[model samples]
Target chain A: MHFNMKLGLTLFAIYLLFYCGFVFINTFSPQTMEQTPIEGVNVAILYGFALIVSAFALALIYGVFCRPEEEVNSTSDPVATTKGDV
Target chain B: MIYDVSPTAIVVFLLFVGFTLGLSFWLGRKAKSSEGYFAAHGQIPWFVNGVAFAGDYLSAASFLGICGMIAFYGYDGFLYSVGFLAGWIVALFVVAEPMKKLGKYTFADALDAKFNSKGIKLAAGISTLAVSIFYLIPQMVGAGVLIQPLLGFPHWVGVLMVGAVVITIVVTAGMVSTTYVQFLKGGLLVVFSAILTILILNRGLETKSNFKELGPVAWDALETAFADKEIEILPNDGIWKDKLDSDQRDYVVSRNPNDPPGKITVWKQVKDANNLVRLLECQLLETRAGKRYINGLPEGTGEGQAQLEPVGSLSKLPDDKTETGPLGAFGFIKTIQNSEVKLWRDDKKFPSLKNGDKATVYYPKLVPGSQVLRPGEHPKFAGIRRDGIFDKLNFLSLMLALFCGTASLPHILIRYYTVKDAASARKSTIVGIASIGFFYVLTLFLGLGAMTSGAMDVSSSNMAAPLLAKSISPLLFAIISAIAFTTVLGTVSGLILASSGAVTHDLAVSFLGLELDDQAQVRLAKIASVVVGVIAIALGILFKGLNVGYLVGWAFSVAASANLPALVMLLFWKKTTKQGIIAAVIVGMVSSLAWILLSQDTFKSVYGIADAQGVVPFSQPGIVTIPLGFLTLVVVSLMTGKSKS
Candidate 1:
C-alpha cells in the first residue's frame, strides 16, 4: 500500500470522528454547546471554529507528510486493495 | 426592498464585468484545442487552482446565503460553514489526487476510466447533468437577488444578465478563463470579507435598533391612525402574530386604490415584555405587476412612498453599555452572548383586512444572546431541540450531506483535472482547504456583524452580507456587490462547463458512440454550454424568491447520494463492478431527487401544498440515501460476480 493512501485514510478517520462528535453534541446535548468554555465564545462557536481550523491543520499535515510515490498506483490502478465484499 | 441603485455601484459593477470579459477574450486563443478548452492543458498553477476551488465552492449560497442566515438566525448558519469546510477534508484526503490522476475532463471521465462501459458513461453523465443543473438553480437565483439592489433591475433581468455574461465566459475560453476568473474572485472575496469583518468589530454592537429611517409610526401614532381610520386593525383569526392577540395588536394596515393591486408592505410595531416599543419592517412582494411598489406607493424613498428598511439590531447591550466601542473578535462574540438581539419574525397566517391580499407581518422578537449562538434558531436546524427521532435525524441528515457532498460535486470534481500531476492536485486541495476554511471562519463574523448591524433584509436572508456592507459604506457595498456577482459568475461558469463536458465528452463521444475529433468536440462543448446556461437562467427566473441556502442543501444531498458511493467504493473495494457503479449512480440520483421533491420542505415551499406531510421521514435524504447508495452498489456488485480487478 502507498504511504499517501494509508496516511490519507488515517487522517480521514480522525477528522470524521471529530466531525461526528460535533453533530452528536449539537443533536443530543445542545445545552452543553451553550456553555461558555472560552472567555466569551460558547462551545458551539468554539467547536465550530475548531472544526474549520482542524480541516486546514489536517490538510497541512497531509501536504507536509505525503512524499512523491508512483502516481499510477493511486489513480490508474485504484483497485490495489482487495477488501471483502460490502 | 427598493434599494436606491447607487451610481458608484453601477460603475464598479460594470468595471468588474468588463475586466472579466476582457480576460476571457484575451485567453480565447489559448483554448483552441479540446485539451486546453476542457482542462487548461493541465497547466493551472497549484495555488491558483486552489483559490479557484474556493471561488467555485463559495457560490452565492456561501457568501450571501450563509452570511444572511447567520445574520438573521444566529449560529445555525455557521453550522453550514462547518459542514461545508468538513466536506473538503473528504475531497483532500480521498478524492483529490485520485480524481486528478484518472480524469481528463469531467467527473464522468474518472468514473469511466476504470471501466470503459457505455452504461457507466450514460448513467454517470446523466448524474453529472442532474447535479450540475440542481446546483445551478441557486447560483442563478442568487444572481437575480443581488442585481435587484445593485442595478435596480427586476429578478428576471438579473437572471438573464448573468446567463448572457456566463455564456460568453464559457464559450470564449472554457476552463482557462473560468479558472482565472475564479482565482481573482476568490482572492477578492476573502480579502473584502476580512475587511468587512474588521469594520463590524470596529463599529461595535449597540443597544438601540437603527430602523427609524423607514419612518415606522410610534405606538401612540398607530392608535391615532387606527382611530382616524387611516388604517384598520386586523382581527385575529385565532393566530397571533408574534405573541400579540388580535385585541392587543398595535399595528394597523391600510391599502389605497392607487397602490399596486395584490401587493402588501408591512410595518410592525412590537412592544416587548417590558413595554419597550420596537419598530420593524417587512414586505410581501407581488412582482407580477408591471411596476414595483413598496407600502402602497411606487418603490422609492420619496414623498408618499416607502421601502422595506433594514431590520436586525441589538435591543440591549451587556452591562448597560449602549454601545461597546470597537470590540476585539472574542469580545464581540462574548458581548453578543450577554446582550439581547432583536430578530425579525415573519408570520404569513394573516389575511389582509383588504380583499384578496396576502399579508406577511415581520415582527421583532427579542432573544437572549446565548440562544442566538446555539443551533436551534432556524427552522432547518430547529429539529435538534426536539425529542422526535425524525426531527433529530433531519439535522443529522443535513450535516451528513454537507460533510459528504463537497467531494461529490461535479463542478468541484472537474477542477482536479485543471492542474498537472497527482502531487500538484494534492497541494492545490490543501490550498483550497486553507482558503475555504479561513473564509468560512470569516462567515461567522460576517453573519454576526450583519445580524447586529441593523442592516438586514428580513424578506431575503441572501442579502445579509451585501446589506451589511451597505451599512458600513456605499463604496464598500458597491465593491462587495460586484465581487458577489462575480462569485455567482465563477460558480455558474464552472457548473456550465461540467454540464457541457458531460454532453459532448460523456454522452456524445462515449455513451452515444459518436465520432468526433478534438476540434469538433470543443465546438460541441461550447454549444452545449450555451444551452445549459440558458436552461439555468430560465430555472433561476422560475424559482425566484426561494431561499438560496435550502436549494443548495438539496443539491448537496443529491450529489452526496449519487456520486460519493460509486467514487469511494471503486477506489477502495475490489468487488465493485461496472453494473454496481451504474446502479449506484442511477438509484442514488433518482431516489435522492425524488425524496427531495416529495419532502415536506418542497411540499410547503415549492408546491405550495400547505397542511400536508411529506412521504419521506425527513427533508434531507443523505442519511437514508447515502447508505442506500452504498448498499445498492455492494449488492449489485456481489450479484454481478465482479472479480475483473
Candidate 2:
C-alpha cells in the first residue's frame, strides 16, 4: 500500500482535536451550565467523537510507525504471481 | 391505531414495498457470481452509497420512534436524532477508510484482516450475528407497528411481512439488492421529508384558542329533551351539561375517532342557579362557520409552526430540537432540559395547573395503555435521585451503548466495503453525515410541530407525526408515510444482509474449514437469510408496543460491548493471541447478554414481570458491559501472551 502524508496530517489534526476535548472536559462542569442535562448530551459528546477520531489516528499511527518498513523495491505482486486463490 | 391509517395510506404502502422487492428479484437473477452476493463487486458509486448509508442507518427508531418521542416529550426525541447523527463523525473520521481497506464480505473480515485467525473469525462472526439479531428485532417490531395501523392488521402480520420481504431481498441479490434498496429508500425519505417541511413552512402555525362557549346550543337541545325532569348532580362539584351534538357539516370527520378535526377549543363555563357555583370544562369544538360541534369531535389541528416565522436553515433558531440558537451541537437541548424553561401541563391532570400564573396546557387525557408504556412517571434514573443506585447504574449503562455502539454496527461497517477506495469511503461518510444532519434538523420541526398542532394521539406517541401529516393533506401524508414504510424496508434489508454475510462467509467458509466454491457459499447464504428473517419476524412480534428506537438502544450497547473492544485490541495490541480473541468475544457477548436479561428493563418489559421481580435495578447494561468487555480483552491478551509466540 502507498503511504500518504496527507492521511497522516489529517490524523494528527484529529489527535489535537481529541486533546482539546479531554482538556475541555476537565475545565468545564455540567453544573456551570444553565440546565443540568440528564445522562444525555454533554461536552463529552465531543469527547465520544474525539475518542473515535483518536482511535482512527492511533490506527493510522500504527500503520505508519509499526509496520515492518520495506524498500519501495518490489513492484512485483507476490499474491498475483502465486495465485493462491484468496 | 390502525383506524388512524387512511385508505390512501394502504395503496401507497403496498406500491412502495412491491417496487422494492421487484427490483431485488430482478437483480437476484443476475447475481449468479460471488461478487454479486458480497459487496456488490465493490463497484457502487460513492455518491449513491453515501445516501444508501442514510437508508441503512436510519431505522424505524429514527423515523418513528424519535418522531413519536418528540411529539410527546417536545425536544427530547430530537436529542436521539442529534446523537445518532453525531456518531457519524466517528464513522467518517475513523471507521470509513480503514474499514474499507481491511475487510471483505463481513465485519469479521475487517477485524481479522491482520491476524487471519480462525478464532477471530468465529468470535467476530458470532458477535456480528448477535448484534444483527438484536438490531433486527426493533425493525421488525416497527414494521408491525406501522402495519397494524396502516393495513388494519395485527402487529405480527406487519413483522412477518417485513421479515419475508427482506429475507427474499437478501437471499436473491445479497448486498447488491440491499444497497440499491437502501439507496432508494434513503433518497425517498430525505426528499419526501423535505417536501413536507416546505409545506410546513408555507402553511405556518395558526393558534387555536382554548376558550370558547358551546353551552347555549348544547343547553337548548338538553332543555327541549328533558325540560320536565330534574337530574341528580354532585353539589358544588361538577356541573351537569347536555350531551354533545354533532356539527351537521362534518359529522363524517368525527367518526373514526382517529383524526380529530380542526377544533379551536375555547373554555366553556356553566352556572347552576340552584347552587350559585360556576363549573368550567375544557371543551373544544369544530365550528361550522361560527357554531360548535357539541357531541361530535373537533378537527385535528394543522401541523407545523403556525405562529413562528421561518428562520432559514442557519438563522437565529427557535428553541427547537435542532441546532437552534448558538449552543452548538447540543446547546439548545442542554439549556432546555437542565434549565428552567416554560413547561406547561393541563390543570385537570397535574392539578398544578391551578396556579394562575403558569401557562395552561391541554394535554390529551392519559389512556389505559399509555399509562403502562409512558417512560416511568419520571426519568428512568429517578432511582438515582431517590437513593436508587441500581436504577442509576442501569441508566448509565444505556448511555454507554449509545456512546459506543455507533461505530461498531456491522451493517454500517459493511457499507465501507462496497465503496471502491479509502478516499471515496471517507467522502461518502462526510456526505452521509451532512444528509443525516439535515434530516435530524427536520425531525425537530416535525416533532415539535406535532406537539402544539393539537393533532397528537396521546395514546400511541409513535403515530403523532404521521397523524400530524394526515391533518395537512392525504396525498402528502401518503407519500411521506410510504417513505416511512420504506425506512423500515431499507434498514431491515441491510441487517439481513449483514447476518447472511456472517453466517455464509465467516461461520461457514472462513471458520468451518469448508472448501466450497463461491456458488455453494452464495446458496448457503441465501438459505441462512430465510432462517434469520424468520427469527427477526418472531422477535419483532414479541417485542411490539415498544419504542422501536429505544429497543435498538439495547442492541447498540451489546454491539459496543462485544465487538468494539475486540476490534480495537486486534490492531493495537500486538500481544493479542487467538485464545485471547475467542475469550474476549465470548466473555463480552455472554456478559452483556446475561446482564441485559437480568436487567430491570428485560424483566419488566419482555417477561411481563412486575417491578418486584426485577433482578437488576437498571435496564441499560452499557456502563457496566462496555468497560467489562474492554477489560476482559486487555487482561486476557496480557495473560495469554506469556506463552504464545
Candidate 3:
C-alpha cells in the first residue's frame, strides 16, 4: 500500500473509533453522556463537536500527505496543480 | 397560518431565481456537447467543485430540516448533523479518488466500467433514478415550506415553482450551471448561518416568562371550575367554560393570550357511563373569518395546536452571573449546557373532532440544560436512553447508513465527474468536507438558537431557521430564506442532472444500446430532467407536511443499501462479477424501498394505518438490507466467478 493511503486510513480509523465510540456510548450509556465532562459542557455535545473538528483535521492531513509527488515538485499551489492536471 | 406575502421576500426570491436562470442560459452556450452538459468537460476548479459539493450535499434537509429538528427536539436534531457530516469520511477515504478514476457521467458508469455489462447498466441506472427521485422529494417539500412563509404561496405552488426552476437549470446548462449555482448558495448559506449564529450568541438566552406563569394560572382555574359549576371566571384570566350536550358537563378553557384575538381553545370533558367526567382533552381552535383552523391549518385538526411561548432561559452562568452576554462559540454551548430549556412534547393520540374542528394539544415540558444537550430527546432516539436491544440496533443501523450514504448518493457521486481527475477529486472532497463540516458545527448553534429565539412556528418544525432569521430582522429573513430556496434549487438540479444522466447514458446507451449521437443524448437527458422534475413535484406535494430530515433518512438508507454494497465490493473484492453487482443493486434497492413502505413508521405516519397492521418490524432497513446486499453480491459472485475475465 502507498504510504499516503496507509496514513490516511490510519487517521480515518482513529477518527471512526472516536466517532463510533461517541455514538455507541450515547446509545448505551445515556447517563454518562449527560454528565458534564467540562464545566457547563455535556459529554455528548463535546464529543459531537470533537468528531466534526477531527474530520476537518484529518482531511487536511490527508490532503497534505497524499498530494502526488510530481505535482508537489512542479507547483506549490495545490489548486493550480489540480487545475493544470486536466 | 398567518402568512402575509412579504414584498421584500418576494423581491429577493425573484432576484435569486432570475440570476440563477440568467447564469444557466449563459453557461448553456458552452454545454453544447454531452461531456460539457453532464460533467462540465471536467474543467471546473477543485475549490469551486468542493464548495459546490457542499452546496449539493447540504440540501434543504441539512439547513431547514436539521435546524427545525434541533429547534423542536434539542440535541437529537444535531444527531442528524453528526450522522450527515460523518458520512463525508466514507466519501473522502473510500469513494472519492476511485470514483473519479472510473466513471464519466453517472454513478452507473463507474459500476459498469469493469465488465461493460448491460445488466449492470440497467440495475445501476434504476437505482440511481430511484435514489435521486427519493432525494428530490425532500428538496421539493422544503421549497414548498419556504414559499408558504416567504411568498405566502400555497405548498403545491412552491413545489411547482421549484420544479419549473430546477428543470430550467438542468435543461439550460446541466452540470456547469448546477456547479456554480451550488457554489454560490453553499457559500452564502454558511456565511449567513454564521452571521445568524453570532446574532443568536450576542442576543444570549432570554426567558419568555409569560407562558411559565400562564401554566400555573390556567391549572388553578381548571381546578376551581371543575369544583364549582356556576363559578364566573374573569375574562382577563383567559379562562372560559363550555357545557356539552345539555348534561351541564362543564369543561374549562385556557387561551394563549399571545395569539391574536378570537382563537379558540376547546376542552373536551370525556364522561363515562356513570356521567362522571374522567379525562379533559385540551384542543386549540382557530376560526379566521369563519374558516376553522385546527393546529395551524384548516385541513388537519388532530395535529397538536398548543403553542408554548419560547421558554429557554439561562439558569446558571459560567461566571456565576445572570447572563454570559455575547459568549464565544465554546462559551455559547457551555451557557446552554448550564441553562433550563422548555421543550414542547407532542402528545400522540387518535384524532378527535370537537365542534366541527380537529383539535390536539402539545404540552411544554421543562428540561434541564444537561438533559437538553444530551442525546435521546426525540422519540426516534428514545432507544439511546433506554438502551434496549432493538433500539441499539436501530441506532447502529441509522449510523451505518449515514456513514455509507454520502458516497453512494447519485448527486454527490456525480460531482466527482465535474472535477478533472483522481487527485482533483481528492482535493475537492477534502474541501467539501471542510466546508460542510464547518457548516454542520454551526447547525448545532443555529438549531439551539432557533429553539430559544422565541420565533418558532409550532405548526411546522421546518420553518425554524427562516423564522429565527426573521426574528433578527425582516431583511435577514428575506436573504436567509432566498438563500435557502436556492439551497433547494442547487440540490434538486444536481439530483435531476444525475437522474437524467442515468437515463441518457446508462439506461438508453449502455443497457438498451440505442447508439445515440452526442447532441441527441444531451437533448434526451434534458427531456428526462423535465420528467423527473415533474415526478419530484408530485411527490413533494404528496408528502407535504412530513419533516424533510426524516424523509432524507429514508433516502440515505436506500442509497447505502443499493449503491454502497456493490461499489465497495467491486472496488475491494477480487471475485466480484457483473451478475453479482446486478443482483445486489436490484435486491438492495427493492428490499429497502419495500421495507420502508411496510415499516411501522410508514404505516402510522404515511399510510395512516394502525401500528398493529404494520408489516415490517423495524423502520430502518440498513442493518438488514445493507448486509443482505453484501451477502447477495458475494454468493452470486462466487457462483459466477468462473466466468469472470
Interface RMSD values for the candidates, listed in order?
Answer: 8.5, 9.8, 5.4
DockQ of each: 0.39, 0.11, 0.40
- Candidate 3 lDDT, tens digit per residue, A1-86? 55555776787788789888987887778888888767668888888888999898888888888858533432222432343322
Clashing pairs in 1: B1-B308
Using alpha carbons, what is the TM-score of model 2? 0.72
Query: What ranking of all candidate models by lDDT puts the best one first?
Result: 1, 3, 2
- Can you write out model 1's per-residue Cα lDDT over B98-150, one digit (the tens) per residue? 78777788888788787888998899899999999999999999999999989
lDDT of 2: 0.61
**Number of clashing residue pairs, candidate 2:** 28
The TM-score values for the models, in the order shown, are 0.91, 0.72, 0.88
Q: By the lDDT metric, which is better: model 1 or model 3?
A: 1
Best model per TM-score? 1
In the range B269-388, model 3's lDDT, one tens digit per residue, is 344455444333233435445665553435332334333333333334444665555777877787777777766555434133334333445445556777778888888888766736
Candidate that would win on lDDT: 1
